[model samples]
Target: MFNRTENLSLYIKKYPVISVLIGMNLIVYLLGLIPGIGNNLYALGIAYNYSISQGEYWRLITAMFLHGGFLHLLFNMFGLYVFGPELEQLAGKLRFFSIYFISGLLANVATYVVEPLNYASLGASGAIFGIFGAYLALVYHTRKILPQLKQLIIPLVAISVIMTFVQSNINITAHLVGLAVGFILGMFQFTPKRIRRFREK
Candidate 1:
């Protein structure tokens, strides 16, 4: 049964974007593990505010795919795997990509603005937070479809708050900004026509 569940069509037909994203992240991570290539990649793309100021602007996006370690990669990928597909199916591919990438960039920008000059970070936490915020918005907009999600609101917020304080390395600025951006975007009332048709299947 578990094997059958793993072979479900939603992964292939509905969540191609998520599959591609995870594949890209994993490929980059593997490449980073090769000798000498790691430093070069980090130098070119990691989100060090100082490096970004010097005109390596691509770091803003590249950093989203770069992980600090295996556990970092695992957590971020897990979040994406869990939260991404339903939202993607609901919003359609283009809008889903917009929410993920745009919110991530804005989150990095917020971190740069609020944190110290020497501060540096990397990972998809901000993007995941955006997805989380988007999910919150969806739950608000379509409460009747998945009313049980309402139970998650307080715990999610409380956990975010607690994690921000307890974990010194976590980027609270990025997380909060991403969540705010996603929430605002989600308020735009964008239920894809495909979602309705797909659900009827």
Candidate 2:
């Protein structure tokens, strides 16, 4: 279910939301490759606590689409590319969008609340981690039939959390908060009654 065998056109047609997200991140990253404008845009794009305090609250949302480097964009987009569609299919587009963006915003907000005002972070890792958290919720929800999911998802989540600490410049708070919020929302969004109803259907 996580595999993608579709061509570009078919993929976009099948997963319009994920495609747009990946495209937006790609566009932002490409624009940030520019010489002078790059630095300026990045300064504005990051989720800076000072900026948020100064009433530039949009950074929480905008930073979800920004990246520090090519690999940063690539990894985040790849996570979206692989995991997003299944959740979109299961949760529907609106719910999927809510889970992703809300988790990201909450993550950034958590950062704003805890970190120094000078703190700034840019990347979709928070949102991607939300997707991971949602997957965990799903596995727990459907463990009877989809027990196999734990093997893939648990290890992936574990490795990600581990990497968060092992890697430098990683926003540990955002990632953890996003994951927690995503799991909560996932549980709220995909209730037991709903899951049972879905299986019945």
Best by TM-score: 2
Q: How well is each residue in 1-201 modelled by candidate 2, as lDDT tens digits?
A: 677888999889878888988988888888888999888988888999998999999899889988888888888999899888878877877899889999999999999999999889989988999999998898888788778979988998999999999999999999999999889889878766777766675
Clashes of 2: 0
Model 1, runs deviating above 4 Å: 1-4, 8-10, 144-146, 189-201
Candidate 1 lDDT, 1-201, residue by residue in tens = 002244546576668888888999999999999989988987788888887888778888999999999999998898788778777877778888888888899999988888887989899888888887787776676577757766776467568667866986888888888888887777673454444565676
Give the alpha-carbon lDDT of every model: 0.80, 0.88
* Candidate 1: residue 47 lDDT (0-100): 88
- Measured against the true structure, the TM-scores of the candidates, in listed sequence, are 0.88, 0.93
Q: Candidate 2: which stretches are off by over 4 Å?
A: 192-201
